[model samples]
Target: MNVLNTDVLVIGSGPSGLAAALEAHRNGANTVIVDSFARAGGQYWMQSKYGLERNDRQMQAGANFITNSENLGIKTITDAEVWGILPKYRVFIQQGSRDSIEITARALVICTGAHDFVMPFTGWTLPGVMTAGAGQRYVKMYGKPPGDKIVLAGSGVFLWAVAATIVKAGGKLEAMVESSSNQFRLFSLIGRHPSRWTETRRLLSPVLRSGVQRLNGYRIDYAQGEDRIEAVKLRQVSNSDRDASQELEMETDCLLVSHGFRPITEITALLRCEHQFDTKKGGWYCKTDPETGATSIDNVYAAGEVTGVTGAQSALIEGALAGLGVSEKLGFTRNGIERKRARLMKRQLRTARFADGLAELFELNTNSMPRIDDNTLVCRCEDVIWGDVLKSWDDGAQNLQAVKYWTRLGMGRCQGRICGVAVSRLLANQFDLDPRIFGFNHPRLPLRPVTVNVVHDALARKSL
Candidate 1:
């Protein structure tokens, strides 16, 4: 195993990670970035591999940022997955097929980002059903449409982004169903952040020109098909105590669904950093200082979605702040550092207001989860359905851990990343208690899946 050392180590290559590395390197800290993907850019800045000329503003900005990082001589370990972090910031990484490495850093910046949050419904696990993020990556990164006839049913502006990507890829967008009924809230965003008008217009232009049907206050009740998604049943999401609205069936080969995004907090959780649950900020996110992105632990900081899903703009600012925070902690402060921090802090406040508006615009109602069929699989990894969870509840399983022990609801390859949120909601609805009371799944060693050989080699190393 190769041993490496750096003054600052960043665990992601997205907007936050890249910004963090760049700032740290520029501030005279030996910086290194490690990412699980083969390339530096994370999902939001996913680069195209098809070698096709395109005019994507976000992609171009990401390319420029990555180029700047490379030009600054920052080391980035690609196609590497960090499996464990030991005391003193010793990170064990499995790089590629035949390489394993240990990196010890004086300061660590965690920007693992967030993943799609999808609630379970009937036929959700069937073929041609995926999250909106997956569909976007398929079109943006691989340059291939996920399906011919696509129906995006979820909440948030992310759905619109996916719809635009599909349209750009020349895929047929059947419709876009958003559960949020607050269309007026969207206009309020332009008032708060007038600069967003251009981006918002650009994002909505393609979908509007393509004449895709946009259904507000609608949700997917269930998906239907034989071997793949042939149709989806949509129901109007009512806020009042009125009679249920009629279900509408839409024929489509693909169904992309997302309730929202949840922060990837495994690393912070594993390190026992303080966390608080706020659905608007992406549930169970790491608690950090607003000014510096410092976590509860010393010499460790968190930024970007790991702190909360505040989008890319805020992530970039938070990342730079975290970098500066680390540099200051390491006694590597340069001239005008305090002034730069103040400016970033003020900008973060503005972006945070925008993020708050976004959260309100796409707020999810947990009460609706109880309406899902009992046969719907909540934990896709362990094949645990609502019925199974109810049975566990009947058997005296009151908490998430107890349910896991009784029905294996979260002991799967994803380690509860995919199923934890839904199961928590199910239990909260079943027991009529606050979802936070159940807490999240406890993180264990080997944060991500690792081969036995890699673990063996890591254990054999003296650094362990």
Candidate 2:
């Protein structure tokens, strides 16, 4: 087991973590930033070459700011996955399958960001069905086209970005979908739905700029084809309309879906950090102060989507805030830094407010969330299917935790990091639990996976 020490350890190399690293280094704290991805740009940089990719001039500057190790003392590690966190500030990590390292840090900054939601629908398991993020991944990371004909569906700017990328890549946009049904429905609901309308405008502004045709208030019935998705069948959902007024079918090879993001809290959950189910952020967000990004644990701060599902800008701001707070906590910064910190925090607040509005409108539909079909696999890690959980539910499993236990749904290596949130709701709906009792099945620690040699050597060190 190799051991290294740092004043502060920042996990993730996204916009926020980069900001945190720069702040930590500038304040004279020795810091190391780590990410699982092969590249430093997190999703944005990794996805930059895509047709709809971002320019990210600010993030580019931040990255450049932190690259000077002699100036800022920022050390970045890529392709590293943290497996576990111990109470004594020992982080067990696997750099790869055979190699392992343990690092003890005075403070920890988590900026591990969020995951886009994949609400299950019929034929969602088909090969052509993918998240808009996946489509972006195809474009930017893989430099490949999902298909020549793509239908970008779902609400929010991300889906629109995908549409733009596809069309810009010369892929045909068979259709672009939004849950909001019709123009008349907006007028009818205007008096009673002012907040919704405001959110609509903020979210739709980016979508409209993409020049994608809209299919409002449509629910996809399923995709057609035996092995691959040939086309999608969508039916108009009720908005202000009293009935399902119209049905539309579009020809496309790929159908992209995105319902927004969930805070990726697997490592934090492993640390046993206090959590709150914030539907606004789309998943279990760490309990942290709005000012400092400090969580329940002392000297361990969570920034970016690891704390909650805010976008890149919010992540950048919160990462900087957490980095600043770490400086103050570690006694690294001199006087007068708070003024600069306060200014940045205020800017972050504005973005956070905008994020609040964006988060609400693009959230996964409550009615469309239960994705387990009789044959559809729910826990990919364990190969558990809907029928398995349904059988467990039939046997009087009343809560998500219960279904998990009976089916071992989250007992796999990924430890339900991916499917736990979706399954929690499915159990709640099936068992008729007051939706309120949908308990958290958050991840557990030895946060990083370890091999026998690493564990044996670590236990040997404990003997010393």
Candidate 3:
């Protein structure tokens, strides 16, 4: 086995990872960055090639910030998917071509960001149906169009930005269904986080000009078609409390659905770090001191979406804080930049947490998902269905763990990374309750998919 040593390894090349690496490098600590995607910007730059007319600036900023940081001694590992973290800060990374790497660092910053939350529908498995992130990536990175005529259906800032991207890509948007509880309620919060106003103005600028029709109070009922998505049905959502009413249905060829993102906290949970199940941040977010971004695990710091889904702004600040803390802990701060970086990071932290109303709307609730029948497919990777989960419930499967075993639900190539929340919604549907009342089974670590060979190698070299 080969070994690569660094003073700090910051995972994920998005805004957060970029800031962290920049801070660490500026503080005179050796730092490397990695992400599964090919480029530096995560969502900001790559959401859609036809981003909102105004999004170009931010994406450019993110790209420049990261590339510049990389040029200044930040090692970058593009197209690398990390498998797991060993006990002694060894990060096992698997590149896209299946080549593996073992990265041993004195401190680890988990800037691995969040993914879009998908609650399945009858025809959601169809071709035209995808998460908002996927739809954006189709145009942004791959140079493909979402479709000629499309409907952007979901909540949060990403949905609006994606809608604009579609319009800018020369694709016609038929409708946009928003699940934001009430944008008016948080009007006061916008002041606290000044940066949000800037981001919001930028994201919404293009969509407003695109002339895409806005469907204010409707949720996607299902995508209906045989081979691929040909039409989407929508129900008029009632006031914030209940599901959509069956009066309204939008006739369209494609439906892009995403209600923001939940925390990718499975690996964090596996570490047995203390977590507080805040229904506000979508799912369970890591409970860390806001200042250091340090979790309960010693020398194991989390940044970006793995800690919580606070958008690019929050991720950058948190990553910088973690980077400073890690450098100080590892004695890389002989130049006194740690104190300065920490102060700057803390100031930016408050700027990012500004009145994010998306947090209130997108909670871990089965009620938010489109109606699921007993035969509906819940786990896309393993082909597990609602019937299988319900059958487990019928056989006395009480909690999420029992649900997982009875249906072999979470056992798959990607593990339960994607479908964990969807299955939780299915289980909560079995009993009539909000998913927050009882969330998914506590996330066990080794968050990414790992092979036996990687484990053996990591264990053999754990003493670094």
Candidate 4:
């Protein structure tokens, strides 16, 4: 392994990460960006490794970003997985399975994005049931539909986007379900954020034109089949105050459900950054100064969804601010730096207002856990059922950590990323406390699982 040094190191290749890298380089800082994916664009612009397509606006933008970043003189390492970060900005990365690399940077920008926040329901672990984000990735990135007939059920506006993508891709949609029933929010957003009207229309046009059955305020009660999903049970909630009562069942090959998105904060947590639990902004987020993107840690900054779920446009603006902040901190003072920062900050504020409205529209009802049978698996990794969790609690295993100790709730292949939130919410409800009281799982390195060979190679590379 060889140790590489740079002035700024960005941890993701998404919209924010790319923007940060370009801005930092333009401001006269030696910058390096790394991503686990083979391609630069994150989920929004998931261009396939085989080739590029300009059929869609996002793909075209991604293509342009890739081409522009190539000429910007910023080093970008793709197909590399960063496993660990230590004090003094030391980052350990593994390329493929065997090779290792270490990078040290004066200023760090963490743009690690987010993942679909899937709230567990009865039979949610069925084979054909997947996250709405995962379904979109399968269609957009891999060019494969998750199933022959897809039923989209979730909160957030992203559900419509996925539904449209499927319908546009010549696939069949069994139905589209949104747990949000307040349709006035859409009109309110249009009135407040006129610029977003076009985008909102674009995402919804195909679904409406297809005339697919769209259910609002309906929750997927469960799915039933022997091995994969065959039928789904839905309950209609008339209002937020009322329990879902009107039951409906439909046959479908695939069920896509996502409450929203949770920020990917493994690296931020690994570095011990301060966090705040914001349900509206998707769960626990690494706190950063909105203007500078500076975290509690000196010389370390954060931007994009890792900060919160502010979508791609806001991420672009935040990333630029972080980059400029890094440039200034590293003694690379460019002309009109303050003016540039001010402009970026204004743009961020505007986007945030609109994002807040959207969040209000799709906020999840975390008030209670979805109705589940006694045998429903809560922790998929450990095969821990709801009964097991309750049993552990009755045995004096209080709090999430205690439940984990009793039943290994978060101790699995995912290292608690997937099951942690669901478990926390359940515990919060059981304890009659806010979900944030329990906090998130304490992440340990390596954040992701690594093979023994990779570990040995990383160790052998260092002669200390």
- Per-residue alpha-carbon lDDT of model 1 for 354-417, expressed as tens digits? 9999998888885233146788888887888888889888989888888889989879989988
Off by over 4 Å in 1: 240-243, 367-371
Alpha-carbon shift of residue 426 in model 2 (angstroms): 3.0
Each prediction's whole-model lDDT (CA): 0.86, 0.71, 0.71, 0.84
Task: Name the candidate, 2 or 4, with the larger lDDT value.
Answer: 4
lDDT for each residue of candidate 4 in 94-179, tens digit (9 for 90 to 100): 88777778898888999999988786778898899999988987877666678988899877889888887787767788898888
TM-score between candidate 2 and the true structure? 0.85
Clash list (residue pairs), candidate 3: 49-140, 193-354, 270-444, 270-445
Candidate 2 overall lDDT versus native: 0.71
Whole-model lDDT, model 3: 0.71
| Cand. 1 TM to true fold | 0.97
TM-score of each: 0.97, 0.85, 0.88, 0.96
Best by TM-score: 1
Top-down TM-score ranking: 1, 4, 3, 2
lDDT of 1: 0.86
The weakest ten consecutive residues by lDDT in model 3 span 46-55
**RMSD of each predicted structure:** 1.5, 4.6, 3.4, 1.9
Candidate 2 RMSD to the correct structure: 4.6
**Candidate 2's residue-wise lDDT over 1-464, tens digit each?**
77889999998888888888888887889898888876676764453434233343333554464455425546777777787777657877677666667789999988888877776666777788888888877766655668777787766657655665555455566678876433344434444535445545544554466566777667666677788898887766644542344667788888888777778787777777788877777667888886777889888898888787777778888888898888779989867787977898778766776667665555555433322468777787787888898898789876677888899887787677666777776665665654446656565545545677766766777822
